[model samples]
Target: MQERPPFKTLFAVPLHCEGCISSVTNALSQVEGILSVECHLEHQLVEVEGTAAPSKISKSLQDIGKDCILRGSGNANSAAVCILETHAPNVENPVRGLARLVQAGPEFTIFDISLKGLQPGIYQASIRQNGDISNGAASTGGVWEEDTRGTEARGRLGQIEVDSEGSGGIILDISVAIWELIGRSMVLSPGTELFRQDDEATLVGVIARSAGIWENDKVVCSCSGKTVWEERVEQTGKGML
Candidate 1:
């Protein structure tokens, strides 16, 4: 009889539709240490079962494009499982992530902007006000646009050049939350394009092989004899392939 650690921090959120849920699920599943996930569209609450810290969870959720807020936690009489492994892709230089911008559509345009001086790796790709929200993320790569939407409207926003003067900015390992477009940049809308790499933005990630493992876990209440099983998730290799 093994006692599992308690799960914590449930997140309740509001997504536009079932498509939104699918997008969120796909994004979060890429996280390395997540244990369980229950996304209920009826209540708009995504119950993520993991043993990681809340800050870590919050960052991960943001990376995947979730407007997540804490709700509650329960010590359910359930079986808990944990996994640990490494994986890589089959590409020369593989990024650690592969996100599809599930917002931008086929007609989203990436125009240059200039309120002043702009830098590479970081630029604001203006979003057309009259574009479809389903277009997905707007970036210079094909990864986000593929999983998020497709390769119909792949384009660049702006390039980024890292400053090496020492006072470097903080970097996030969003290699998991591949992106596309959403809300309008100059304007505001649901389908508006959301991601941008302005001059101030720094690119900090490595392309490598991705490898992961799948674990079959079940929760059985040692006291009540009730069981919670049939849970699974796919660990993907990012970057290389």
Candidate 2:
């Protein structure tokens, strides 16, 4: 397997003094894929550089009694995101998963995907040619074609097994560019086959550009007048991972 290159990710952490910085640094050092950790006490921010999944980094901080919100990741114009949702009839909450994509190197992009409220089975993830989700996954076109690597189907992102709790995730690098994925769509389907039109279990979402490292620094939402942590609490209550 090719080693994944390290990428930078910024987090909004609550830091007050040198002790807080030490605690945060020490906690991150224990996480297996982290290459380095930098804390900015004045901004209450932590910059992590490595192959560690953002979710794992956040969990590590949570374990140390410090909550963190990912502010940005990767380099400028090298990050994107997608929120997978189900459009099945009568579904109260459509959101079922999230995908974070970052260009870690010139040859590939890293994908950190998580799914919840799904059946216990294997799910196939793929990038589609179209971003349409009006009729759910059915509306999204076929797998994106990689002209440079003809017949290779670079869009196929392999599979993730959902556990009994309907949760599954995978973190790995794919041979695709972040710019190429923006405005496209990602679909998660049950089983080894690509998504079928009738499969209600299918989750689909459009990929959108996300902030790169240091691109976003606001600690509060101007529209909601809520701090990052406050917004995080609300989002957590809504089943955001």
Candidate 3:
């Protein structure tokens, strides 16, 4: 059988100058499965073409002190993206990821989740509301719903199976409005096995909900009244679009 072509992904990172671009391009080119790396400094974007796992690419850039947010696979319309992070203090192996929501129809959305640094196995993922965990609280229990008390599964996102390299991706069909999902979070937890055990450690970290959906041609920044793309375009110009 013939090998498949490498996939491409865009990352919104901190790229300020030619030096930064060269550094990121060189660093990504060294990754084993990466086929090409293009840095758009004006837009602070790094476009990577590769068969390597998405998480691996994100981690490599992060390891070199370049924080990045996955911006989807070259498509920049009507999408919301989040950077998933670990909140556990004592855990050694940390989980990191990117969750993207794309409008599929009137009332349905597709969730594209890519994660790294997880144990190789099956895991359950769900969308959770921001509960009573006050903002000033020391720890919000990492936002994983503890029991069935007030937590009801809104949409069955999908199952993610991490490979031996601790990287995985899954597409979830969500039956909800994009507007309804803005401030809520996504959580990855152990499968039903954890339900039987009284262990709090079964909880995984909360996904850092970042951008909201773009309605029509407008950028949906509830606070600033400007969309993220609009701000990027204003600073970087139409070339980014």
Candidate 4:
């Protein structure tokens, strides 16, 4: 049998001196399944080559007082890209942006979102139950919906601030199980928004889906893709139409 290649992960650290470099390198080396640890002091980055669980490696570094940011990893592969769309198609001007989700660790995912051509202000972000980007549609429900407008905020993603140039960026650290969010969509409301009870008033839309769902190397939803509703039926044996 051919030997599998070792996993590699690059992390950004705060190494200021040789001692700090030595400490980080030694600590990572001690972790089980770690084949090698290389520190680049000039860049304050450490590269670990091994088969260790990413979460375990991060915890080991934290144990030694080394705070690290994951730059990239062999184990970190699942991700999705989304193009933000406006809810109202007839509106003369619309919000435009892109968002990406990447698996950061075993229990956490990172959401990197950027927006342009938006009104400069604060907006509320949340994950909704539908990946529908259409002007009007009904959702086949399989996920939790804590209604923020009427009852409570179920999947609150906090607020994002658009700057003077109508551009904004935010990185979200979500602790929810990533698999649960696979088929949902992200929605951004206009203004310093409160939980909106009306669906027609939403400003932006982007489907949150697995990176694997694509056609001809392009990600799209045109009634020809594997849908969240299908997954729900398979899991629960309940046909969703």
**Leading candidate by lDDT:** 2
Please give the RMSD to the true structure for each candidate, in Å. Answer: 18.3, 1.9, 10.3, 14.3
lDDT of 4 by residue, 1-241 (tens): 2223345666667789999988888888888879998888886678887755555566688899986655565442455555565555465444466666655446465666777667788877777666664542223221236643443444677788889897777867666546667666677776665444334344445554433212112223366565433443353332111
lDDT of 4 at 143: 22
Q: Sort all candidates by lDDT, best to worst.
A: 2, 4, 3, 1
Tens digits of per-residue lDDT for model 1 on 1-241? Answer: 1222324446655667988888777776776556777777876667776544334555577786775544443332111111111112232332222111111113221121111111213222222322222222223233334344443323222222223331111211111111223322221111223343221221112211111111112234466565322111111222121
lDDT of each: 0.33, 0.88, 0.57, 0.60
Q: Backbone clashes in each candidate structure, one number apiece?
A: 53, 0, 1, 0
RMSD in Å for candidate 4, one decimal? 14.3
| Model 3 per-residue lDDT at 48 | 83
Across 121-188, the per-residue lDDT of candidate 3 in tens digits comes to 78776565542223211233332234443334453355688788977787565565566766555556
| Higher-ranked by lDDT: 2 or 3 | 2
TM-score-wise, the better of 2 and 3 is 2
Candidate with maximal TM-score: 2
Least accurate 10 contiguous residues by lDDT in model 4? 212-221
lDDT of 2 by residue, 168-216 (tens): 9998788878999999999999988886574558989999999999999
Q: What would you estimate as the lDDT of candidate 4?
A: 0.60
TM-score of 4: 0.49
How many clashes (backbone atoms < 3 Å, residues ≥3 apart in a chain or on different chains) does model 1 have? Answer: 53
